[model samples]
Target chain A: MSALAEILFGGLFQGSLYAMMAVGLALVWTTIGVFNFSHGVFMMLGAYIAWQLVELGLPAAVAFPIAVVVMAGVGWILQASVVRPLIGRPNIVLVVVITTLAAGSLIENGALTIWGPRSKQIPALIDGNTTIGGVGVSLHQIAIIVITPLILAALWMFLNRTRLGLALRAVAQNEDASHLVGLNVTALYGLAFAIAASLAGLAGIFMGGYRFMSPVMGSDPLLKALIVVVFGGISSISGPIFAAYLIGFFEAACSYYFGLYWTPALLFGVLILTLMVRPEGIFASRSRGLA
Target chain B: MNPILTVEGITAGYGRVTVLHDISLEAGRFGNVGLFGPNGHGKTTLLRAISGLLQAKSGRIQFDGQDISGLSARAIVGTGLIHVPQGNRLFPDLSIADCMALGAYSPRARPHEAENREKVVKLFPKLAERWRQRVRTLSGGERQMVSIGTALMSHPRLLILDEPTLGLAPKIKDELCASVMDISRGGVPLIVVEQDIEFLLELTQQLYLVNHGAVATEIKPGESLDHGEIMSMYFGH
Candidate 1:
């Protein structure tokens, strides 16, 4: 019973991180019609920025938020300079893949060149451990479990309730219609990237507090996030959030039973089977959308 | 009286194939104008050029005396020129209420959102009952109402509608025609492109027959909306 509880707890914690990472990827994809390959690097870069801020003797709270803010700026620039120019060009889908992939590669190398290859950890929001329902878990894990939903709820409200959020969704649904409705489509696209990047940054901080982070630590999480997004459905914002928890639990069960080496294989197999069964998505319907 | 919008010798197209060749027309401040033509000729293309959705490869467009050829579609909308394009191009997942909010997104329109929304609801009373319903659940007629209602939320000085009644039931088309007539009676000028010739004639005072990407004919006042004459005048030339 205790082992089962622990496994479930681990899944929940892991899923929170995946949800944070995947939503950004999904937002950019739905809004701009391009997959941002640099999203992983945004995570690594965010963690590094937080670490540097902490090293410079700032409080973790201040440093963490500052890092997320910086990532937002970086994301805005990425859209303006890289993504915006490529829009309206023929074969933009293929071209964006190459450009963002190259941009991610460059940023990854820049992190390595500047921060060195040594894995580093940031101070956790809480320094102690706690027992929850017969499972031993870090308070940081508890923090993640608790905080992620609030952030997600905030995001949900922003997308559904606020005027700007509604406008962002309008852009996602029909770009030309959005323009006709008087939305600044370019600015909204940039806003989507910025929000996605900031979420990735916060997820990075959460991961860095628990596990060590290096210039390349973003890869594993990135791959998982991509799977979660594809598995859930890229059409609606809620789809990936729902899938992340399912995958998180699935991964936990696999880790406990089949072991670590088998988790990826099992996850990939499940993804393939899911795709074969429902090519549209696990949760998306035609009427469901980001707006 | 001065024209509200003027397009002078504008030529635009998609890519290398020019869809609108040297198309020019003027819209008066007091009366609605209708553009009619065969499918795939240039009626919709001309609307696209006027609204700043397509940049003219050459020539100028002026709206309310502000040379607006350089403005983007969104910027053009700030001047209260709203386009409710064909097919009720609303986000399917968005609720009617949310759609209305997005319709008034610009600074120029936001201030009048409350007042304009009242007028829109008055124009389409069914919309008030279906406020929380997503656009996907709306019927063809209801979607058209939301499309026009959303445009009205922008507080348009001059409204442009492309095929607002296409693919609707005859009953629904009559309902929409009544609402559109009320809209014109409310004093906002309209640029309507519709396949329903009777609807076009009843709604607009000035008529232009667009053919092969140019203004092939312009029927001034004293011209009757005689179906036979219009058919021959448009098809004969």
Candidate 2:
């Protein structure tokens, strides 16, 4: 039925956004050995930046890219000031968790204060809807579905083919050896954060195109991204991506059949079962491999 | 002429536990030196400090006439000191070919990437056959070959190997020793640490006995004592 296609397409569309956020989360986790708790806030900030730019009369095309660039800078700054300082300490992991969690809270509260908690939305990049097989679909949804895979492929190529990406992978695998092999590891860490932020920012822009985004809108997606990253192996880029879409489809199906209210419970139940069976992860590699 | 690399009265260690105490050693312009000692006696720590993974708390390190006591590990590697650390510590997920490319990541080594890669493949032809294999899948000896080959791709002016043949079958160890000899014959200097006195005697011109985190004795391997005598000397038997 066309209704089936609609759900599938809807799942794929939402899955694309989840993939973007989770991939970034996974990259930062592997690189810095710290799970950036502010990752979701970065998404919220990106949507806000794009909204502000559009408010200043910049078109969606210009605003989205500018927001991504700005988010890259913000990511680098976050790593430098917030993350980099705490590396090599005795209790770095614990310290970083607390610090980043506090930083996320501060940024969220600050955004709330500045943006006034008003729900804002960006006009869709292309303002049109079309029916395919008697199921109505928005053009932006199709665009998101098409665009995400290409971006992920580009990322894969960068990681597997380029020398810089090789260095990032190397750092993730054995940081000491990466430095011993003459990599500028600090710079690579900064790059990982920057790239992750850009990806998260794009996800935010895509989200704003479809739904009203408030400062707190990121928390839900953040939780979803966490699930995706865990479901996928955090050690590799492609793992989180596949898991993201799979989770997205699961969410859609559960919402449709089990009712929206029961979706969360079912998701958590399945996640718990999956973990109980395979505590490492669903896509876990035997050894850490960033690519 | 000044020695190629010199450590003058260096004191270094991990956090709060001092290991190398007032250790001083030097390598000639174009000769291999060996260090042998009991386990946990600071040979690896000395290599770590010399390679810039650890800082000398109370002395100076000069490499090719440049003062390099407190330089970062990357900087030291850029200065053409390549260390293939102990225990095949490598990025297990990377393919052998990828490891070779990454070894030449420093600007100083980039220019020589092509020839160095050729040399590594030629030195360890087994590595060439499994260019796309992940390091984790490789056998122990094969991983060691990849580690050393990866180091060779760095165009090292000075190559340091910590227990290059620590654990392997005798036949594989022989092949590795021959390959290392070939590397040395090709004119790259070596600072090797090993437990096999026969291997050390064959490889190094001079040997330093490290004990209690200091150089306890310096002996020319082919000079006065036999290999058994030297082993006893190192073990303090």
Best by DockQ: 2
lDDT of 1 by residue, B69-118 (tens): 97999999999999988888688878999989988888999999999999
TM-score of each: 0.98, 0.97
| Per-model lDDT | 0.90, 0.89
User: DockQ of each candidate's interface versus the true one?
Assistant: 0.84, 0.85
Q: What are the runs in model 2 whose C-alpha is more than 4 Å off?
A: B221-224
* Model 2 lDDT per residue over B1-109, tens place: 4578998999998889999999998986437999998999999999999988888788999999998889999999999998999999698989999999999999998
- Taking the tens digit of each residue's C-alpha lDDT, what string does model 2 give over A120-163? 99978678999877778889888898999999999989988999
Model 2 residue pairs with clashes: none
TM-score of chain A, every prediction, order shown: 0.98, 0.97
Lowest lDDT 10-residue stretch of candidate 1 chain B: B216-225
Instruction: List candidate 1 stretches off by more than 4 Å.
Output: none
Candidate 1 is graded, for docking, as high
For each prediction, how big is the interface RMSD? 0.9, 0.8
Q: Estimate candidate 2's alpha-carbon lDDT, on a 0 to 1 scale.
A: 0.89
- Model 1 TM-score is 0.98
State the fnat of candidate 1 relative to the true structure.
Answer: 0.83
